[model samples]
Target: MSTTTDTAPTAVAAPPVPPRGGVTIDEWHPEDEAFWESVGRPVARRNLIWSIFSEHLGFSVWLLWSVSAAMLPRIGFDFTVSQLFVLVAIPNLVGSLIRLPYTFAVPRFGGRNWTVISASLLLVPTLLFAWAVQTPGTPYWAFCLIAATAGLGGGNFASSMANINFFYPLRKKGTALGLNAAGGNIGVAFIQFFLPIIVGGAGVFGLVQAKDELNLERAGYLYAGLAIVGAFAAWLFMNNLSGAKSSPREQLAVVRYHHTWVMSFLYIGTFGSFIGYSAAMPLLIKINFWNQPVPEVPGIGINFAYYAFLGALVGSIARPFGGWLADKYGGARVTFWTFVAMIVGTLAVIVTLRQLTPVPPSEVPADPSTFVYSEATRAAVEANSTIFPWFLAAFLFVFAATGIGNGSTYRMIPLILQRQAEHTTTPETRRADMARATKESSAVIGIAGAVGAIGGFLIPLTFGSPWVTDPVEAVKMAFGVFAGFYVVCLATTWFFYTRRVTVAGRAPALATADV
Candidate 1:
C-alpha cells in the first residue's frame, strides 16, 4: 500500500459509491498510500474482476468461428479447406481493425458505459453465427459476413486494457494488467477445449449426443448467452473513474512518438504470431495429423479437435510469466531473447515439415489391366505418424515464445515512455511529465495491439488452404517466412532499447534503471 499522507478527511466509514446506474468515482488517488488503502484498492479490484469477465467472453466470441470451422465437414457445410480458412481468417481481419475504434471508446463513453455497450454488442455476431450455421446451405458470403461480426470480441481487449491502466498505481500496474490480460487470453484456450465437448460425441454427461455428431451452432449460442451475462455484470457492478478520462488530443499525442511505431512493428511478431498461430492451429492439426485418433480412453476414432486447445492453453498460461520476467530483467533484453526463441522454434517446425515424404502421383496402369503403388504413396501415412510429435513440440515452442513476447513487449512500452519522459522533462516538472508519459504509453499500447492482431489474418492466408496441394510444404514455407520476421524484431529491440547511447556528455539507457 502507498504510505503518503492525505489531506482529505479520513473516511469514518466505507467510501461513498455512486447510487444510481453504474458507479462513478470522481476522486481517485492511487498513488497516495492513504487514499489507496482506504478507497482505491477495493474499487479497482471490483472493476478489474468485471473487466476480466467481459474481456474473457470477448476473446471466446472472437475465436468461436475457429473451432466451428473445424467442425464444418461434420455439419455438411461443404466448404473446402481453403474456404474454411477464409471463414476463420475473416474474423481476425475484422477484429484487428475493430480494436482502434474500440480503444477510443473507453475515454469517449466512460469505461463502465463502454464495457456494457461493447459486451452487449457481441450478441450480433454470436446470433448471426448461430443462425448461419443452423442452415448448412447458408451461402459462403453470408457466413463470411457473420464471421466478421465476431471481431466485436477482439475490440474488447483494447478498450479493456486501456481502462484498467487507469485503475492501478504505477507500482502495481504491471502485475494487475498482466493478470487481466492472461484472464482474457486463456478464454481462447477454453473455447477450443470446451467446443468439442459441448458439440459432443459419446455424451460424457448426457448433456449432448451419444454418437459422434457436429452441433456447430452450439458454439455460437454458448458465447451469446455469456455475452449477455457480461453486459449485465458490467452494467451492475463496474465503475467509471474520472481520473481515467482523456481527451482526443492527449491520447493522440502518442502518434508523435517514434518509438510507438517501432514497438508496434515488433508487436506484430509477438501478439500477431500468438493470435495468428492460435487461429490456424486447429486447421493445421486436423489436416496434418490426419490418421491419429485423439487417444480416447473408452472410444476409438475420436477427432483431433479435442487436443487443439493445448497450444492456446500453454501460450495463455505462459503470458504472465513473461511479464514477470520482463519486470525482473529489462523488458528490451527479455523481448530480444523472446524473438530469438521464436526464431529457433519456427525453424524447428520447418525442419519437421521437411522430414515428411510427399505423397506421389498415382501411376498409370502398367499393362492396361493393373496398377502399381509407388513407394512414396505407401510411406506417406507412416511419415505422418513419424512427424506428428516432433511437429507438435516445435509448434508448442512457437506458441510459448509468442506468449512470452506478448508480455515482454508490453512491459517494455511503459519503461520506454518513462525513459523518454526523464530525458525531456525538468526535475521540477517530473511528476507531470511521468503522468503524460503514462497516458501516451496507454495510447501506444492500444495501437500496437490493433496492429499486431493483423498477424492472425495473414498467417492463415500464408499457409494457403488447409487442403493446399502440399500442406506440409506450405507450412514449411510459412514458418520460414515467420522466422525471418523474428530475426528483424530481435535486431530492432537490440538497436533501440538495449544498447546504450551518449546523450549530451553521458551514456543514458533507453530502458533506464531496471526498466
Candidate 2:
C-alpha cells in the first residue's frame, strides 16, 4: 500500500498584477492601506498625470477666445466692446450647460473612454477658431457659433475631476484633486502668456520681437495639434475602473442633498470668480489702462498682453497650498477665511476704479490705426496708467483668494458626504454605504462645477453690459454686487459647516467630521 500511494500537488497563490493601459480594472480597493501602498498609489498617479495633461489642453482651448477677443481689433475685425465681451462670454455659457452631461458620461462609459472622447472634441473648437479668424467674410453670428464650440473644452474639467475622485482615498483626495485642478487652472496663464507672442502682437517679456503683423490663426493651429496629442495620450495610458460604474439616475440623486446645493453656491464664489475674472482680465486692462496707437505715439501705453497672465499664474500656484491647509486645519475653516479676503480685495479694486476717469465710448476709435486722442482722452489714459499698479495688485489678491477657496470648497464635498454616510450606516453595512457616498460626492462635484461656471458667463457680460451706457460704471457696480455675494457666501459657510449644530441625532456637528 505504501509503494502504490499517490501524492497530490499543493496550490500556490499568485502575486497581484499591476494595472495595464486601456484595460478595465475589475478590483480596486484604494481605502485599504496595504493595497494602496502596493498598487493603488501608482495606478492613481499614472491616471492623474494624463488627466492633468488632457485637462490642461482642454482649459487652454476653452479660453482661446479670452485671449483671441482682445486681439481681434488688431487683426481687422471691427467689433464693439460689448460684442467682444459677448464673444468671450458665449464659451462660458455653453461650457456650463454641457458640464452636467459630461459628468455623468464618466461613470456611464468609463473614465478612460470619456477622456479620449472629450480630448478629441477639443479639435472642433480649435479648428473652427482657425477657420473663423482666417476667413475674411465671417459674420458676427458665425463667430459666435464658433466660440460656442469652445465650450467643449470646459466640460473636460467636470469629467476629469469626477474620474480622479474615484481613484484616491479620503485622506489623499484634497491634495490629489488640488494638484489636478491647479494643473488645469494654470492653462489660463499658459495661453495668456504665450498666445500674444504666437499671434505676433507682443514679444516674450518684450525681449523678443513679435511678428510684423498679427496672425491669430497660428494660435488655433498650435492648440489643435496639442489636442490631438492629448487624445492619443489618454487612449494609450489611462484605464477604466469597474468599481466606478453607476447609473445616471443614481448619480443624479445627489442633487436631493441640501449640502449639494449649498456647495454649488459656495463654488460659484470661488471657481466661478476664477474663470470669469480670467476671461475678463485682458479686456479690462486693454480698455482701462491702454489705447492702441496712442495720440502722437504709435505704441506708447500699457500693453495688456504683457501683464494679463500674472493673475492666473499666481492663482494657479496658490491652489495646491490651499488644499494642504484644508487637509491640516479644515476645509470649511479655510473657505471661510478665503471669502473674507475676497471681500477686502474687491473693495480695494473698487477704490482703484473710482480713482480713474472713465473713457467715453464715443472717444474709443473703431479704427485705432487712423485715430488720434483728444486732450480729455489723453489725460484719462495717463490717470489710468498711474492707478494701474494699485488695480493690478488688488485683482491679484482677489484671484489668490478665489484659488484658495476653490481648493478648500472642493475638499469639503467628499468629507461632508462621507460624514453623512457614516451617520446613516451600521457596522455591517458601513463599506457599502461609504462606496455609495463616494459616488454621490463625485456627482455633487460635477453639479457644483456646472453651476459655478455660470458665473464666468455673467462676469464679462456684466462688465460690458449692452444696457449700460458707461462700461466703467458697470464694472464698479459689478464689483459691489460681487462683494455682497461674497458676504452671503461667508455667512453661509459658517451657518452650514463651521458652526456647531446638531442634525436630527445623525451626528454631533459637521465641524467634528473635519469637513
Candidate 3:
C-alpha cells in the first residue's frame, strides 16, 4: 500500500489545519503525517462509508434492467432477444457518456454536494421503471429512453472514485479505490440475487402475491425506496475537502497524456468485461437454454436466476484482493496476468459454443410419419445439456479475471502519474513534489474512467447485434473478438509499463524510479 514517493518534508513546519464548517474543509494535507493522524483519517473514513452506500445503490439501479428485461417475456411483453439486449445495453451506453461530465462534478460542486446530487438522480430510473412496466403497449423507443435514465447511477462511480481519490494518500490508493469499486460492483449481485425473488415470489418472502404472476414492476418499486435512503445518508454524513477542488482544464488535462489512454484501454478490458458480462449473463442463460426444463420448485425454474448472481458476486468480492495483490506485486505485473486469464476464459466459452452438437436420430421415420431432426433442434438440445456447464465455467473465469484486472489497473494509475511527476519535477521540497504528483494522478483517473466505461456498452452491443443471424453464433464470434482484444491489451500493458528500457544510461522501467 506504500509508494516509492515517500520522502520527508522540508525543515519548515506547515500551517495549522482549519476546522471544517458544514461540509467544506478549507485546509487539508494527507501526506502530512501529523495532520493525517489528527484530521484526515476520520473525515476520509466518514466520507468513504457514505460514498460506498450511495455508489452501491447507484450500481443496483443501473443494472436493474438486466433482471427486468429477462422477465419481460413471461410477464406478457413480446420483445425479441435482440430488442431486450438493446434495452439492457442502453444504460451502459448512457452511463459511459455521463461519466465524463460526472467526473468533473466533484470538483465543480463539492464532493459531498455532488454525491447527494448523483444519489438523488437514481430516483428517475427507478420511478420510470415502475411506470414503464405498469403500462401496456410501451414502445421499444420508450423503453430505450427509460433505460437511459439508469445511466445516472453509472456516473456515480466516476464521481465517487474521483472524490475518494482525494481522500487517501498515494500509499493507500489501491485499497480505497478497490473498496469503493467493489462496493458498487456488489450492487449488480444484490439486484440479481433479490430481483428474481421479488418478481417471482409474489411479495417479499411470498408473504403476499405481487400484482402480476411475475411481478416485474416490483423490482422498480423496490430500488426506489433504497435510492432515497442512499441520497439521505450521503447528505447527512459526507464532507468535501478544499484540496479536492480544481478547474475543468486541470481535470481534463489528463487527456493529453499517452499513459491515460493506455490505462483507459486496459480498464475497458477489466471493468467493461465485469459489467458487460454481469448484465448480459441472465439473458444469455435464458436464450441459450430456452428449452431446458425447470425442475419442480416453489418458484420459477431454469430461468438462469439460479446462477446469474454468482458472476457479479465473485467478481465483486475478488476486486479488493486484486488491489491488495497489485499493492504487493506492482499493478502492471498483476494486470498482465489478468488479461492472460481473460483471453483463456473467453476462448473456452467460444470453444464450448463451437463444439455444441445434437444427439443423432436413430433413423428417419417413413412416409408422413417421418420425424425431422434439424440443426436447430440439435443446437437447442446441446445448449441445454452438454454445453451449459462449460459455458458457465468459462464465463465465471472471465468475471474473476476481470475483477482482478479491475483492481490492478486502477492501482497502476496513480503510481504511473507519481513516477512521471518525479521524473520531470526538480523541486527541492518533498511536499511540493507530492502535491504535484497527486494532482496529475487525480486528473488521469477521470479520463481513464470515462474511456473504460465504453467497454460496457460495446460488449453488449457486439453480442446483441453480430454480423451473423444466429444468436448463438453471434455470441461465439463476440467471445472470439474479446479474446483478441485482451491480446492487444496484454501487449499494450507490457510495452508501456512493464517492459524495461534504458534511460540516461541506466536500465529501469518508466516510472519505476518513483512509483
Candidate 4:
C-alpha cells in the first residue's frame, strides 16, 4: 500500500521545537527505543524517503561535472576528450577512496552531525566550479581543484548507507538499504537528464550569465542550491540514530572476514557496472547518435546531448526493483542471473558498436572514436542504431542486478556471520542470544558497505580502455573482458555458500533470513 508517492512528507512526525536530552532532531527521531521499534516503521520509512531525497541530491551535485563536462566546449573550456574523461573520473576516484573514512565518520560523530558536514561540503566544490567558470582566465588547475571538490558529495553515499544500517532489523536491512541507495542513485540519472534540459531549454547558465562573464556560474550555483536544500532538510527532519559502534580496532577487526573480500569483488561487478555505465552514457550517445548542436559563445561548445539520459535513468530505476526481486527470491539467485545478464548486455553493445561505427578513413564524426564502421555506412543504416538499446539494457540489468545483490548479499552477510559466530559459541548461549546476530551484522555492515562502494569508481576505470585502433573492435575487446570477469564472479558465488549452503535466499534453498 505504501509507495514513495503515497507517503506525504507533511504527515510525518514533526521534530520537537527544542532539543531534549541529547536527542537527535532531524527528519527522524530515535529518541525512544521502544517507540522506534513499534511505531518507527512509518517514521523510518518517511525518514528513508527524505534520506533518499537528500542523498539523491548529493549524487546529482556530485555528478554535475559529468553532465557538464560533456558540454565543456560550449562553455568555452577547451578540454580534450581524455582530459574530459579524467575530469569526470576525478569525483569518482576521490569518492571511491574516501568511502572507508566516510563510513567511519558516522560512528565517530553522530550520523546527524556527519550528514550536515558532508552535505554542506558540497557547496565548496560547486561554488568553486561556478567561480572558476566565471573567470574566463581561470587555469585548468583551478577547474581541476573545483571538480575535485565534487568528491565531497560522493562521500555522502557511504555515510548515508552506514547510518541507515543502524536503523533497521537485519531482516529488513536489504529493502531499507536498497531504497536508500536506489533513491540516491536516481540523482545521477536525474542530473544528467535535467542538466541538459536546463541548459538546452533555458540556456542552462541563463541565470548566472552576465554579458561580460561566462554564464557557467549556474552549474556551481545549482549544486549549491541542492546542497543548501539537503542541509536544510537534514537540519529540519533528519535524526541521529546512534549505536552500532565498534572501536576503530573493532571495525578493523571486520576486515578479517573472507566474506568482506568476496563481496567486495562482487560489488566491483554489480555496483561497478552501475557506476561505470552511468559515467559512460553520454559519450556512448554523443559518439554514436546524431545530435542537434547550437553555437554558444565563439570559444565554447554548449549544446546538450539528448540520448544519454535514458541509460542513467534505466540504471537508476532498476536498482530498487532489483533489490525487491532479491527479497522475493535469493540474493545469489538474482545476482548470478543478473551477472549473467550483464555479460549478455555488454555483448549486445559490442555488436551494436561494431555495426554502427564507421570504417577507417571514413566520413564519421570529426574525431576518431572507439567504434568505426568497416564498410561504407548509410544514413538509413545509421538511423537504425543498436547502441542506444544495448547500452540502456546493459545499465538497466546491471543496476537492477546490483541492487538485488545488494539486498541478498546484505541478507546473506548477517546470516553468514551468525552461523560463523554460532560455530564458535556454546549451544545454550547461542540459543539464549537472538540479538547477537543483529549486533554482529551491524558491525560488519560498514565494512562491507565501504568496500562495496568502491565499485562505483572501479567499474568506470575498468571500462576506461586504453586508446584503440578499431574503436568498435577495441570496445568489443574491452566489454568482452568485462563480461568475462562477470562470469568468474558468478562462479565464485556458486563455489561459496550458494553452491552447498542451501540457504533460503539462495535458489530454492531456505536458510534463516537473519540478514
Best by lDDT: 2
Q: Which pairs clash in model 3? A: 202-210
| lDDT of every predicted structure (CA atoms) | 0.79, 0.89, 0.80, 0.63
What are the per-residue Cα lDDT tens digits for candidate 2 across 1-515? 35776788887866566787788888888999988988898889999999999999988988999988988876778888999999999999999989999999999999999999999999899989999999888999999999999999999999999999999999999999999999999999999999998888774557756566778989999999998999899999999988899999999999888999999999999999999999999999887788664332354457888888888887888888788889999999999999999999999999999998765433436664567667776777887889999999999999999999999999999999999899889999998999999998999999999999999999999889888876677788889999999999998988887777645644345755269
Residue 460 accuracy (lDDT) in model 1: 82
Q: Model 3 over residues 399-481: C-alpha lDDT tens digits?
A: 99999999988889888877777676775765666675676676677777777888888887888874567777777778889
- Which residue runs of candidate 4 sit more than 4 Å off their true CA positions? 1-22, 25-37, 201-215, 290-304, 359-395, 425-443, 462-466, 469-473, 501-515
- TM-scores vs. true structure, each candidate: 0.87, 0.93, 0.87, 0.79
> Global CA lDDT of candidate 4, please?
0.63
Candidate 2: lDDT over CA atoms? Answer: 0.89
Model 2 error, position 238 (Å): 0.7
Best by TM-score: 2
Pairs with backbone N, CA or C atoms under 3 Å apart (clashes), candidate 2? none
Model 3 residue runs over 4 Å out of place are 1-22, 201-212, 292-301, 358-383, 428-433, 502-515
Cα-based lDDT at residue 63, candidate 2: 90
Candidate 3, residue 45: Cα displacement in angstroms equals 1.7
Model 1 deviation from the true structure expressed as Cα RMSD, one decimal place = 6.7
Off by over 4 Å in 1: 1-21, 201-210, 291-302, 359-379, 426-431, 465-468, 502-513
